[model samples]
Target: MLTAPIERMLFGLSDDHVIVEPHSGQLMHPEALVAFQRLSADARDAGFDPQVVSGFRNFDRQRTIWNRKARGERPLLDSSGEPLDTGALSDREIVYAILRWSALPGGSRHHWGTDFDVVDRAAMSDNYQPQLTPQEVCDEGIFGPFHCWLDKRIAAGESYGLFRPYAEDRGGIAPERWHLSYAPAARELQDFLTAARLRDLVHKSDLALGETVCEDMDAIFERFVRVPERCYPQENT
Candidate 1:
């Protein structure tokens, strides 16, 4: 297994790399939080409003989401957003189904506090439901303008060092248009994490799907955690 200190930071179990900056509903990384503030301010000036919906989730929180989906408490979906019948699946199949939309507990970037989900405040009411579907980020959806503005910022080098990790369907996970990652820190963490370390850590855990995750560590690391280095911003590349 990897060293404890490194593992702690990687899994977001320690606060060594982050500060408790209030954002959305939880604390966030100081650096990422500053960047997000600037970006949000810019967006507001342009007649758009972006609000964080999630940030800095810990291991237990991730486990709850994972366990719920694995046990069919939450709806699992295919790449096309069709409901999956978890009752018909083996434990292994259920693990994969959950991974299609959720990350293994320790492997989620939310642990690092440098990643978060956002919504356009202009498009939502007090009763607005959060489906977080890709269709909702399309040109016709309420958040369409927000994402379009983000794209233009990325293309013009105006984004405050944020980018999408799952910008497309990569076969291992679904496309989550709402998720934004701080490139500088996220890239460093992503590069340092290895399949061996991730597998070893997860295999040693008591999670219900631990064995299933370790069963194909290579593919999971490749598809879920490690994107092509080139896909990241210049610093990561």
Candidate 2:
């Protein structure tokens, strides 16, 4: 394994001007920063002026979200305030749901500060709800214009090095159609963020679990978490 010191992976926010929120962790990587700026600009051009609803998050924030979900303090879809029956779910199921709702902290691509959740800014003030569904954006009618703008900007010829890591295949993760990855450091960051490490972290955390949690965790890792990094290749060419 081409091991890099874990400490070397540590980085901080690039700018103080950007609005930082509880779950919106520090912004990292110049390419991603530019990509986001362009995304915001493109949204404005499309007459939406979408803002980043969520971004980089740490393990603590992730845990808080997960705990809230378990306590039925939030909704499964939007901010519905209905907690999920975590006791009925296996560890793997819980982890999978958690990933769909929030990343596993250290295992999150956002932790690298390269992935962001872009949302319609106007819709947020209405009720702090998501403006578009996953299907709505995937279709070429609702969020298609924004998608087209993002696609054009992230093409191989773009200087920003932004690429859609989860655009095509669902890959078991949530179909975050708006999420984008900055390739320059994304591959290394992905390698550093692995399923094994994430599982270990979950085991060490205060996650509530049912009787089948361990087995569910084993299955989840085998099925989704342990998949090889074929999509994210090494930083070559």
Please provide TM-scores, in order, for all candidate models, with all chains considered together: 0.91, 0.65
Q: Which sections of candidate 2 miss by over 4 Å?
A: 1-26, 38-50, 75-95, 120-132, 140-142, 169-171, 210-237
- Judged by lDDT against the true structure, how good is candidate 1? 0.81
Where is model 1 poorest over a 10-residue stretch in terms of lDDT? 228-237
Q: What is the lDDT of residue 119 in candidate 2?
A: 56
Residue 211, candidate 1: alpha-carbon lDDT: 83
Top of the candidates by TM-score: 1
Model 2 CA lDDT for position 134: 68
Stretches off by above 4 angstroms in model 1 are 1-3, 20-23, 235-237
Q: lDDT: which candidate is best?
A: 1
RMSD per model, one decimal: 2.2, 5.8
In order, what lDDT does every prediction score?
Answer: 0.81, 0.53
